[model samples]
Target: MSELRKKWITAPLLKLIKKVLPPISETEREAMEAGEVWWDAQLLSGKPDWDQLLSMGPPQLSEEEQAFLDGPVEELCRMVDDWKISFEDRDISPEIWEFLKKERFFGIIIPKEYGGLGFSPTAHGEIVTKVSTRSTCVGVTVMVPNSLGPGELLMAHGTDEQKQYYLPRLADGREIPCFGLTSPEAGSDAAAMVDRGVVCYGDYKGEKTLGMRVDWHKRYITLGPVATVLGLAFKLYDPDHLLGDKEALGITVALVPTDTEGVTIGQRHLPAMQAFQNGPNWGVDVFIPMEWIIGGRENVGRGWYMLMSALAAGRGISLPSLSTGGAKMAARTTGAYARIREQFGIPIGKFEGVQRRLAEIASVAYVLDSAHKTTTRALDAGHKPAVVTAIMKAHATHGLRQAINDAMDIHAGKGIMDGPLNYLGNVYRAVPVAITVEGANILTRSLMIFGQGAIRCHPYLFEEMLAAENPDTKEGVEALDKLLPKHMLFQVKTFIRGVFHGWTGGLFANSPRGVGYAAKYYRQMDRYSAVLTLVTEISLLSLGGGLKRKEQISGRLGDVLSQLYLLSCTLKRFKDDGSPREDRPLLEFAMRAGLHNIEVSLMEVFQNFPRRFLGQLMHFLAMPWGHSIRTASDRQSHACAELLMEPSETRDRLTRGVFLGNPGDGVDLVEQAFNKVCATESLRDKLKKGGIRAFNREAIDAGLERELISGEEAAELREAAEAVNMAIQVDHFDHLGTRES
Candidate 1:
């Protein structure tokens, strides 16, 4: 230890820091301590190692995973009639339920030894996404058990006995599992839950043994009504100090069998009328053995950490996959409808307004799908990536909302009038459910993403916090002495990079070779990353603890970080796919949109910085040339929109993994019309050149009579016209909109 340096610098600096450090609540500290940071740390570094991202090989599905997706997944999608599930039946048919059990759909994330499919996270995500396009109810059914449910928890932190017992049951659907975390009074603030387990002797299975008397009421629990076993979170108290010196054991998670006495489980809440099994359950005095505690009694008071870690990987998969499903469904169906349905004697897709909407739909699908694939691969590679997972949950669900809104706007009448043929109707109603669950978008954006990200991703900030908090005064001061200089150097370098990159538009920024069309995007991302790092440091320095209360500022910062990650994923997707020529429009749209969003977010943060002059200065440093970037351009939008309308390889690749259903369904009809339209595009163009603008029986017959088209070509044109007519026709009900009622 350098005694002279410590006496001169560290002693006084530590005293000032202690005076300034905010009082961190137990909950906040536990949250800050949970989950590992990965690529997010690089983006926050301002000098991301481009090679690190490139070194992550392309995402791929194993042969077993691919076979499952092709086999049971596809068959399951075929069996779900979304309209009937949501409206008439209000549940998947009993047959489908049995099919889920037999196929181990609920056990996708469990290992093979546990009798699960033992699929990779990517496979799990792909299955959920593919099924979601068919039915949200079934998707939720599959997603819950695999995600933050008991299955995931048990696998991660279960006792050996708990794993051996519950994992196999959960895998084969012998036990339908749901985790009860959210209570009426403690929704987002789960740590504030009043659910309690009092330590005491209790009777169990004809033997008196050590256990706890638990009482809890939990709501908004997915799979609750139908679950055979339940995972519970509650505060444990040892008023008698039976098993601990402290009365409070913090939050603990335990497994409770639904058949246990005093347990209630047979009810359901209609979530947006989506027909998923979610509702409240209560236990007046449920007694569970000490061994029932997840990871056993030694792991008490660690429930919050366990839940946070589970959510880190789970959030990256389930909701984002579902969100991407909604987006791809919207893109495929809306594009087909826009192409086949005529307005003013031309495909409505030709309208610029519609094209704009279509562009958003397709691009949102593209970006969200890319992120879903990329993030799931990270999970598969054993990276939890908490901050990035939160970003995925927030942005992907928001993207779903945006894409569905555009689809509804385009399908105005069809979307508004919900019926059997309204493919977008059920998904539209389910948007709010996705946005509200996992974590509400408002809270996730305004707080968690950047609020948690800043300390977790920063190289020295968390260490600095720990150093400041160390109980030994001399040790704390010494730690700070070593860290402070490095921290200051990092801030200086970040500021320089921000200014330099902004002035030059990131010309010499590090980027991989063969990025081709994405080289400029990579450079801009690098610039924005530096700008974000610089502004984040300045904001912290200026606002201090008060920045936590300034959610608007934090949210804008979170937006900047999220856009950088999404943009990186988009570029990675392009490179992984060998930068296909056919997919360039989708890639370009995604990159342009992501970079534009980054610019807007950075500008917003700078403009809203607490110090007005400082804000202005940072703004100029971020964009010295008066706003060099704009939203995705109209030409890009046109190209992306046109890509959606036609039956192109790019469109297929973008919209793949969605359910096409039977041959006569609404989506099926749309598909038929789209293909027929493309097939007859040249034939119709030939007729157009012969002065037939609109396809009609009369026009086709006249063309054949005039010999401008062959008889076979005339038949093809007539068939195309009929297909379009059938596709654009809205369903009319017999009575009350159901056939069997």
Candidate 2:
């Protein structure tokens, strides 16, 4: 059986785990049942509901949709591989777009009856990601229309006539569509839009015009200048109350012909160094006929709601696809580089230091690759996941960026310079695009995945936070408001547990790994979470969303969450192919490195945290096997292990003080060990002492030089030269100090 299969079937461990933990209170249980933790808490906090989007209507498609997805995916993969290089330097043209239109690339998500590919989310995701591998510009172009533009909106809310008229033409690329949602004043704050669609229902004219009035100015729109159609959004104003009773009830979605009388296409903006053919589009005072109202005249003032649903689906389509492509480039370059580049007559890959980096890069690349594929499969499974999509967008992009950076480093000078040969160094320069695009990292980092997903991922924080604050939840809270009181009670019990566990050396108390090596990090994470929960509740009481709120729990919690998620991703990738001899190093190294990073991160959080703990707090909160520590110990046991594998006595860095070097030829024993020692902190530090420095060179010439020359004459040799020789000889150390005496 596959390693992943074994891990996949680990149900019994999880069940055993739940039985030992404290049972969630009834109030908190509601949060658990709801599958959200943070946002619900926000609602309970009485924060204004700023979200303009609606119930993301079911994202997963039906079997028919699934059937539609397959063919497009395969074709897209082919196109990507074929156009790989042109994509690197952002090489493409109008001819390419025209060819894409001719090949029906523009219509994958349109309904079949509409003359498009009629593919499902999964299928669309597949095509988009595959193309993104070769060129993300292509992927974005493929994603925009099918996902958030005229095609999705019309399919969801357009009138029968609207779909019949525009769908077929859109599928055939006869009318490319761009959705205008973002503007300078309105980004995350969509309700703040100043642009309005005013009504001019009745005029003293012998003419007939039936629908609601429309006017808009939009920028940063994809497919803007080139599109034959536009889906515009504006605030609904009812002077005659055409859109229900409320003056401005909802944002509205309107289909506007590109050639409308008041509409004017403006200059394009290309920000990402992508193909200019498919970048940003702009327009001013776009006006369309009354029949252009999506879902006819009935759905006015509901544009925000409509756009949200589409954006959610659209995000799942594009960003993840781009990240996947970047990952592929990272793996391709690193693996290719490892196979070639030689130093000291051996491939640099032969060195353990270089090999470790290569392994990590491989591990990350594969993990991201698998995530992209799996997320696509889930999309194919007929379900759209808002949080999952967000997570993918955040994590996958990060992985690609890190992997590419590592790839660039591995290439060193070769990567930094522009070369005649086609390579990933250029791709490395483009790393910021993915990170900055769709959403900025700080926003995504601070608010989106964790800030938003905390609601989805937490077990009790959601409901309890709400119940504690609201009178409406009085009955529910009354039954289980044991929240604050329970936390106090739990801490006492926790102290009791901690005392017993620590007294017993914390062997096999909680967590997955038992005592011997696993008692350091993972268990500490558990401890940290338990402590943070009590503090979080306290903050929820004292400050709601005030100053003390952020301090209740640090971003470290989210960071841990992020690490676990990524490590899980890495492990899954490490296990994808199958267990084999060649894979052992990669798998073990990835797991060990992941565990070490998490543990260290946890330790750092502990150190800088305002809360004080015994300095050895890390010791009590050990890992499953102290994996990093244990790996170092094990490597030490193996004589064949690299000199760089040992931990530094001073500080830690990725390279472990071992220079990324190739040992030169003709090295002697003392020279070799001495050279390695100089590379190491311990020996390096030792050489700095008074006694050591005093004898350093002169003594080396008197005592050591004779060994290199003749036993009798060496004593008469110089001492100053010995120290220099000793320093230089470390790489070839054995050649000196051991000569005939």
Candidate 3:
């Protein structure tokens, strides 16, 4: 075993890393210590068991779930459209709120026996995606209660009595719940919160009993203003020795009624253009029974763990769903607008520059939607997948941000305007909110994904560390004696796998049976997976505990892992959807993009590695194929862009359920007009020959009225003209009260 350790080149480098790198912070250490190994942990370990992943299947929605979506959810969406919820300062209308409460929109995740809808994660994701296409404000309203609130926490860690009392109320809308976790001073570092609760004797139902006096200041609590109940997390103190001799029992979670004395509520916060009911709530020495603690006395000092677990479950569903909605909307609307809104007498979609953006929008929509479905399906299969969820939350939102920006660029001036007809404006403004919430994208990428993932996901690393740290020397040596040989053999296997995959370009890789064209992508994924495993092992061995402080290295490693997962999902989506030939361009584009990103991340890791010699050797071993990996070609981009140039069954199928807004809205109207004017070659030729260059209503009408064109083309020309006119128009607003005066 000692000889095996000596043979590893990174052994001495580990000691060197410990001497040079800063010590790991307590928060970082805690995060690493939290959560058990999940599926992502296994995949990143270089064991690409394709059969097991494929067996999970696509996300399934039951008949009842479909009926609910087509019925009540659909009806609610129509109501939002009719109400024009996007323009309202109050966010959702009272009538719409009542409709949502009556339909039990807030109860999607609660169990049926608890008087709730008991919907699966797939159903939950579908509902959020469909609703988000209509109004972001309304989407946030529906999303908040179902994710990271009392309902989710209660279901996971609540006492039976608490569940019975609170679950039904939450499900039926008798209680609107909001979680008070993020303080103004402690947004991401929740452990730094100053909210405190002291155990003492207090009056409960007119009887003297042991209770807690809690004081809290929390901000950015979604649903805060209207919440009937607050789920509070605060540090608990037992200075009087009321609960044993401990002075502090760490952070604890408790339920507090909003109507309690000295509690302030209903302070609204307007987030950018969004009017969601977000604000601050504070309490001054409010008393609560000991029973209010999430899991009663037995679960004290476990609030952080419970919260992390709840986040693990819900984060994979809500934000990803909303991001999927944004991508789908961008794809559908931008594609149609590009085809219809012509410039230089030709559709802008035909231009190489615009085509590049269009292709990106379409491809982003495909990849993100695939990721959302695959992750939700995994959740439904009963895997919490903490690291996977963090990656999805960060990457999906980032994808949405890029897709919407591309859509805005395609729309040019029209996308920036705010109005009833401007569909992309609201979504554009909502991008920052998604990027900031659910553990902010920056932190998730730089710290959590690879930081926690490296330790939690590795098969033998954590065990080996535990054994090395054991107090009994003989036992510690025995454990290492058993683990070191297997670890050495595993490293050898991974190196060989990497060599085989690199040499063959993944041709001989072990992948599940699939279409012949997709096989190479699977093999490439396998090769990268092996490379990631080797790099991670080398990183752990070279940096030891100090790797936790090397966030740049950790973040790059996360990028490789995340890209692998995204690529895997892309392949799964292609195969699961029947491997259509028309969609091959998109699949190819995603594969190239993912592989290129993996290569870039690996290079960054090697460039920044502390030990130069080991880094160079490892890079050589990993990239035996060559250092430079190829990206998607312009030809591939053009092919994907061509698919989005016109309204086709494939386009509609790809962006299936996005609400394209009303008839006069830019998206739907432009699509209709483009299809109409291009129906006949004579119409196109006459317009081209007549030299009607501009894309306005008058030029199209003038071209049709000329003797060069016939009467049958007149109606199509007029409708196309009107649609173009509406597409370029923006809403007008008066300055303050000047117009009234």
lDDT of each: 0.88, 0.50, 0.81
Better of 1 and 3 by TM-score: 1
lDDT of 1 by residue, 619-730 (tens): 7876787667767778878988999898878888889999997778888888998889889988888888888787789989988888889999999999989998777767
Task: Please write out the lDDT profile of model 3 over residues 1-741, one tens digit for every residue.
Answer: 565654353344333433543344434444555544455875777867887677888889999899999999878877775225645445678888898888899999999999899999999999999899888888888998998889998998899999999999999899999999988888857668899999999998999988899998999888999899999999889999899988988888999999988789856888876877899999999997899898898877778878887888788888999999989988987887887777877888888898889888888999998889898898888878888889889999999999999999999877886666678888898999999998999889998899878777877666566554542455655565666678889888877877666666666776667557788788778888888888888888778767777889999999999998888888888888888888898898888888898998888888788898877877777775565457668888889987777656668767977876555555566656656655643566777777766645566667766765666676666666666666666666686522111
Runs in model 3 lying further than 4 Å from the true structure:
1-37, 81-88, 473-479, 624-628, 674-682, 689-709, 735-741
Evaluate model 3: give its TM-score.
0.93
Could you tell me how far off, in angstroms, the CA of residue 155 lies in candidate 3 after the best superposition?
1.3
Candidate 2 Cα lDDT to native: 0.50
lDDT at 201, model 3? 92
Residue-by-residue lDDT tens digits, candidate 2, 22-141: 233332233223222222232122111212111121135466544434444444444432223333444445565666777677788787888887776656765565556444566667
By lDDT, is 1 or 3 better?
1
Report model 1's TM-score to 2 decimal places: 0.97
What candidate 1 gets wrong by more than 4 Å, as runs, is 739-741
Once fitted onto the true fold, the runs of candidate 2 whose alpha carbons sit more than 4 angstroms away are 1-91, 202-216, 276-285, 288-291, 296-298, 416-420, 458-543, 547-555, 570-584, 593-741
Clashing pairs in 1: none
* Worst lDDT 10-window in candidate 3: 9-18
